[model samples]
Target: MKILIKMKSSLKDIVELIIQEFKTIASSYSILLVLIGGIFIYGLLYNYMYQPNVIRNAPVVVVDKSNSKLSREYTRLIDAAPQVEVYGTAVDFIAAKELMKENKVAGIIYIPKDFDTRVNRGEESIFITYAVTQAFLYYSSIQEASAGAMLELDDRYRPNMVVFLPAKDVLQIAAATPISVSGTPLYNYTEGYGTYLIPAVIMIIIFQTLMMVISMISGKERESGSIRHFAEQGTTLKRVSRIIISKTFVYCILYSIFGLFLAGLIPIIFQLPNIGNSYEIIMLFIPYLLATCFFGLAGSVFFTDSEAPILMIAFFSVGLVFLSGISYPLELMPWYWQATHFIIPAAPGTLAFVKVNSMGASMADIQTEYITLWIQCAVYFILACLAYQYNIKKAIK
Candidate 1:
């Protein structure tokens, strides 16, 4: 009879906590912003910005001082490349620089008068390329297009000279002169920035938005002296677990709907490849959401004001994106940052989602991240309990 009564009391406490959480959410415009605006509204806007996905036909001016057939051929090939367009020919370097200064062109390609002579002499022909500093994509397009055109020209023209060499040495000469390369891009075939960036950014939004909302609520509780009222509920671990579980349940349900939009609907709407099985994506999210919520709750113990967490956590947004190791190579990161990656839920979560969604990875492939998120879930759950226990003690005093 006594054990049953305790179970009943816990159930009643959980229901009351859920009800209070809903009431708090309903009353606060900021919380509404975190739940709705952060997900649906901002989500669409971000997708729209990355709609182009790939950069193409970035303009450049070519300075062809070579005036030889080779330079002209190089120019023709460069103009034909998908990444860049040769907007205009420049009479001199001065003219090319002017165009770049005016922003009329993203880059300048200069083929010196001696370029053909150097190539025919079996010497490396140096072509000067100047790209504007404004956008790295503009520079990338110019460099890629120029380099590709040069390689194609070298392969086609150099082979004719190899015909004159001894038959046995001919193979060696042709192979040695122009090294042939065949590129096979994996995962992102189109090399679209949208494919690479959007997946990771969406996950960060899920994390940061949840943290801010939870932290803001904690800050409000601290300010309102409600931390003291938590003491009245009792200091038992059972009571703390009830409060934590109920709060986590509310956010999980709300975010699950948001996660579906982020993982399922938004991808379809934006035409991001939804290669992963639906069940797998949903399963990955369970630990991710739980970890994020508990981590937020644990970290919120430091907030003394409602606005402090918004200011503090919001600053970490860009850092968190970098930490995802999408834009930057994870292997290149310092040891400490790499160690920190395992501690944070989103680092592995973002990479795992991308592998599954974009790379068509199996459950076994993402097992490392799957396990890491659960580890985080366990660690943060304990931390949140400890934080709440501390709050309860503070309240009693």
Candidate 2:
């Protein structure tokens, strides 16, 4: 009977603590900004900025020194390509450089005077292309369009080289090649910068904001000495466990709504890839949220003031994104970074979400990441309990 009464008291304490956390978050303006404005506003702004997805008709200046029918035809073909438009012709390389300096074009294409001569003689012909270093997409677009134009030019001229042969043999010679190469971009059909990046960014935003909020709340409790009130409730292991549970429960419920808006609605509004089974994405998200929440709770012990978390945790935003392996592949990373992937929730969570959501991978495909997240959850949850126990002890002193 006495044990049952203690159990009832602990349950009541957990409920009260949960309600207190809600009231505290509602009352704190900084917490409100990080919770609502940080996630919703930032998510919308990022998607809006990248909404264009693919760059098209990027302008390039051509230096056509050959001034022949063949060179003119090549120039026309380059302009017709969807990736780039020929803004104008420059008489020489020097003139093209001036246009590039003026930012009049994203790239320059240089066709040498021997361009037509080499083609006519059935010799290898090469043209130079220069793209500004401002953006890789500019260079990629220019390169793709130029290479495509060159292939078309090759087909048009190959028959001319075999003019003396019999018609059937000539046709075969023009068509024959050592090998054929075709490239098809999977998942991201357009190969847009936005499509490739935004999905991962969304997951990072969730991890970061949740971490900041938890740290701030923890810091506030310590700084204001409100932790004493919590400590006074009880210093038993059971009480500390209940306190951690209550805090985690409050954060999870709050972020579940936020997660829906972020993972669900934002992708639809921005037309980002959302092909993953919704249920599986949620299942993946569960461990990720728990891992991040408990990870935040554990780390909050280090924060001495509410403002400290904002200052310190904010610096990690870029680092966390890099660690997620979206910006770079995990296989090529050094052994230590690969190992670090296991410790950080965002890393596996981001990769798994990308595979499931963007690549349409099944739960089976993400088993490694799914398992890693649960491991982090288990590890961090224990750490959070220990951290709160320390805080409660300090408050009692």
Candidate 3:
């Protein structure tokens, strides 16, 4: 009977708390919420906003002074680079520089008049281009295209054979060949950076948005004597856990459908490949969503001021996103940093998302990743529980 009364009272407090939070939020106009929500969602979608990595059709101006077949071939090779959309060739250096300065093109390549003569005479040549850091990706792709052009020449002109030196001294024939390389870029396959970026950003947005909403509301209740009333009377860890579970359930459905619709429907409509399992993506998200919610809850339960949740949530947003491999690749990171990346829930989440969606990785291939996600989820849940207590109510008051 006593336990039942405790449960009933806790339920009442929860209802009151939710209603109070709703009132506070509702004070903002609907248009404001819509605007805020749009900004919030957009932020979640475009973490590296204002300028994203949509490098396709990037502008490149070619200054072809050579007019010869070889230079034309080189110009064609530059045109073929998917990262750059070739603009009309510049008549002179002044025009090329003007185009670059006006932001009409990201870069310009100057193909000197001696281009073919130099190649035919077995002489080295130079190509000059300019790029700002923002245009670095396009610049990188151009360099790769230049390499491919070199390889094209080498393959067409050079032949391998055993050069016999007049007698028994069968020395390998050497032209003192100049070393050359070709670096062809494999594009993002999905045709846009958003495909890769959106997947990870969606997860990040969820973590940040929910962290802000839940923590502020949770913290406010604590500071306003509500947590004390609930704490001194009726509260259980199980009830608190249930509330979190319910909210996550709601948001998970909302976001999962929203994310998948964009990821799936948009790609299919545009003939782009989503190539990922909805089930696996959802499963992968389980650990991350749970971790984020409880992480906020733990902070709210511990902090004396309402602002702590906001600060802590923001700090977490930056750190966690940086570590998630959404911005930087895991393979490129230092070995120890890779290990650090693995420890976070987002690492496994994003990896699994990309594997299942982008790479079409089989479940068997990602079994270890699946297991790791569950382990991390459990670890985070344990930490949140251990760090959080029902008595947080009395201490703040």
Top-lDDT candidate index: 2
Question: Which pairs of residues clash in candidate 1, taking residues 3 or more apart in a chain or in different chains?
Answer: none
Q: How would you encode candidate 2's per-residue C-alpha lDDT over 267-333 as one tens digit per residue?
A: 8998889999999999998999999988998986797789978887778877877888888888899
Clashes of each: 0, 0, 1
Q: Which stretches of candidate 2 lie over 4 Å from their true place?
A: 58-78, 87-180
**TM-score, per-candidate, Cα-based:** 0.76, 0.76, 0.63
- Give the per-residue lDDT digits (tens) of candidate 1, residues 313-375: 767867887787766778999999988888888888998888888888988999988999999
lDDT of each: 0.85, 0.89, 0.61
Residue 34 lDDT, candidate 2, scale 0-100:
92
TM-score order of candidates, top first: 1, 2, 3
lDDT of 3 by residue, 1-397 (tens): 9999978876776566556444655563542343256344454334343233446657788898998887887777767766667787999989988988888887777888888777666567777776645533566666666666666766665542123234343333343555676663343643455555555555555566666665655666666655554445334566555445544454454555555554555445433436777776666666666655656565565655556655665556556656766577767988888887767665666666666776777777778667877776667565555444454535444
Q: Candidate 3 has which clashing residue pairs, if any? A: 276-357
Weakest 10 consecutive residues, lDDT, candidate 3? Answer: 160-169
Show model 1 residue runs off by greater than 4 Å: 58-77, 86-177, 325-334
